[model samples]
Target chain A: MSGKPVIVFDKVSLYVEGRRFLDRADLVVSEGESLVVAGAGGCGKSFVLRLILGLPGMGRASVRVEGDVVVDGHSILAEPLPALQRRRRNMGSVMSGGGLIENMDVRKNIALPLNYHYGNVMSTAEIEARCDAILGDMELEELALPGRRPVSLNRMERIYVALARALVNQPNILLIDEPTTGVSAAAGERLARFCFYYRPEFPSAPAAMEEMSGRPMTRIITTVELEPYLDFGHRFALLANGKIEEIGDREAVLGSADPNVRELLSRSRKVASPGVDDADSAELPPGGGSCWRRSDSHWCHQGDRVKEGEEGASGRTAQAR
Target chain B: MTALIGPIQGLGAQVCEAFTNAWSLLMFSVDSVAAVARFFSRQGFWAAFRVSLQQVHFTGLEALPFLSLLSLLIGFTVIVQSLPQLQGMGAHGLIGKILVISIVRELGPIVTAMIVITRSGTAMAAEMATNRISGQVEALEAMGIDVFHYLIAPRVIGSMVSLFCMVIYFDVIALVGGFLVASTQLTMPWILYSDYILESLQPLDLYISLSKSILFGFVITLFSCYHGLRAKRAPYEVPMVARSGVIQAMFFVFVSSAVISAVFYWI
Candidate 1:
């Protein structure tokens, strides 16, 4: 984590349906840092991401937000719609269902942001080249056919396409919302792996390209299932009951004194080592613990199948490897 | 007293909500127009222009055959039904006046608008509602593409342009159909019948029809786009909004037709 903060939530509170979805939530995410927000279902994890993106419902009237949310050095709430949209150009969001436009084919969906922002400045060849680089980087070139709609791709491919779309603009801040929520566990593992892929390089327009090209990206990912997100970045904020129950280095939060934080870690461990009782899963695996889930007498972690006897409970953690 | 107050409050709330919705629709239509203006000056003008052309092709060109056929039928029926009475009374000269004053001035714009409301207006509403339901609208906005510019403007401008052209086409076709049918019965030369029709067709009638068509197009596009954009997230809302949009568009078309015709003819 760097010394400077790139994203800050200064006592931000969001009220929805006369209930506080996020109240006085405060956190600082440094530039180039990735923070995995872990919480129970409906803990406003996605809501916070929406707030950061300045989506329509995250405002004074609808969600009734209070306090300030500053992203990439500007108050998101203060900016008007167009200004917010301009600011959002630097932020890439992979919303649920990949937020791909069903009307557009896969290639157009990926190129939508590029065509919107730099359509005037960049040539068709340049835009295509950029899009090709992103697809190649995301390993989604197989589905980049000219006329292929989003429905043609399965759940996992859609998520990948969404990520590719988000990253096509080379946004500095990547806000991913539950990329693996509805996919098979195997696909979820692949999605987890795809989230960490490198941004592609291009020699096109230097202004939008330079800011995100060499600089380390700051990613804030929210997920319902914490197992897939366990290894993301170095920092973790445990959000529960519309508040950050615990926030610090991943290790510190994992071992925090807050019961909710401890419980969440334990729950994630349970997801990783399913079929094993809580007593047997006591020792937390070291260095970005394995996201392996034991199902039907085999260990599945990152698509590798290991028999239970050969890879005992202690040897299952393979995310860092 | 309590019962009266309850009913009164409920009515007041309903009125307020309706007024708010109307105001929001107006504002959204205005914003769409402004975005279209901006679209003209910006680099995206060509893309938006292409979309507008496609819309015009869909709403106007593709609709040409059906609209022309309907106009012809209408003109034939009006002339056929009224010719006997006029001939019985020896008022054959008034046939051109009747055709010009009725079909060209009144029926042409209103019927064309009704067709548009059924075809493009409902489709626009459904499409807009689908965009909202499927998250395409939000997705566009999130990508920094203005929803008004990218989605609504082209449809509005295209439909308006298409309606104007359709009205003119309908007028011409209807008059031709009336002339063809009247020639068989009246025993008049083609040139004299054409002259009578052309002479009765005052420039003021054309002006009124053209203005009404433009207004109808604007109203239909505005209402459909507004309703579609405002649809709830539920799947059922898509059909509901389309239905409501069509109904409202038709209502506005009829009312505008009456108001515009009265102002142009009666006043």
Candidate 2:
């Protein structure tokens, strides 16, 4: 919490296909604190990740980055692709839907970033050793082998493999999107714990490897669900209708007058309460009441989904607001 | 008046889009050239070397049989279509000269380019587009790998080398096919036909043929990469870009062939 800011989005606006996706958004995350950006579907969470990654130029439509996005105290938009790519390496991303390169097997997918960064300098044996250590830390020794294809793996296995790939390079900033969409609730909570406090401290790992992985990282994670991540982060940012509606310490914002914030909290309460039915959950948006907080760091399942609890929760939250 | 304004505005937008596409294509070309130069140092020599070898296999070796077949068919058709008129005029001696001029100097390069455009160029565009949509391209960029150097430069260089080799293959098959047909049907001597064909093939013709093949190869790969990069972030855009990429590549091939042919033959 005492570290300097690692990421800064200053009045950034993004317009895609003649429709504004993000409007003058601003946010800052200090080193070593995970910031969860919660928003509904189509609320620019994905665009925010792409924008910070400086991906506006790669698409067909004209991309205009109106303001500054500084990561590690440098202007990412001002730099070109090759330069931007180098800067991007300092950050790791677990893409939505697990963007494993289909052509490469699980081991190669994990080894790709390392090979890219250290291919020129490191010996092949050294790279393999690093990859082995990373695999061990993620506890993926048995399920994923060097030759196992990504498609052959189950959903939870893919998420774990993707997590290994994102952490392989020991990036200073880790970006994850919708980390719990396809996995069991228990698996989701375990993955979230790893994201929050991952340090490569395996006994078999080399000292230098430990040193590289032990550095403080600034993590930025985006999810549609609020309860699973409610008390997991030092700060929270709520995005609604193409704008950051609220951003503050978790408790303050939870208790804020913002209608969106109140709605999110009440939705969390409904999800946490037992006996919610699927029919009610179907009416809400994706990740609406399907997740809730168990304690300070763990996420627990409340119901199959919110069914009868939807109307009651809405009425209660509206009265509270 | 409103109708006229709407049409005018649409036309203006089209013109603007055309210029923008042209500019983007030019920039992509420059970036690709730079990536090629930087490949050895930035991407490492062995990685680029392996990719180049793979491309040679994909674009050249795998395409050999098809190119050979097409060239043979064209050679046979041209000779057969002209056989009656040449026999009546007692002008069998000119058959070799016609083959060398039409098949070797022109058809060999253009046909090879066309086949390559249809096969490898479209595949490369679709592959790149799929990679883009599937987040593989972004993954590469995120990992600090230069997508241009890693994905594009090797393919372009590989296609150029492959097209250059295929032109030789096309020329040999066409001329040999024409020679066999002439010898059997027209009772022409092998030594005489060879001598006549060799005599007709000027150094300029050889230069033009090789140059055209290389230029066509470069244009096709460039257009494919440009269009593939232009594809929007949707699965449907993959096919759309692939189709447009093929069209643009063919258009450039024909246009460049005309310009080069005019400069060599007419000018």
For every model shown, what is its TM-score relative to the native structure? 0.86, 0.81
Backbone clashes (count) for model 1:
0
Return the TM-score for candidate 2, rounded to 2 decimals. 0.81
DockQ result, candidate 2: 0.34
Q: What's the CA RMSD for each of the models?
A: 6.3, 8.6
- For all the predictions, what are the DockQ values? 0.37, 0.34
Lowest summed lDDT across 10 adjacent residues in model 1 chain B is found at B41-50
How many angstroms is residue B83 displaced in model 1 relative to the true structure, after the best TM-score fit? 1.9
In the range A266-294, model 2's lDDT, one tens digit per residue, is 54422322333324433422222113333
Off by over 4 Å in 1: A56-61, A206-214, A253-259, A262-321, B187-189
Instruction: Provide the interface RMSD of candidate 1 in angstroms, 1 decimal place.
Output: 3.1
- lDDT for each candidate structure: 0.76, 0.73
lDDT at residue B257 of model 1 (Cα atoms): 82
Top model number, lDDT: 1
Model 1 DockQ (Cα-based): 0.37
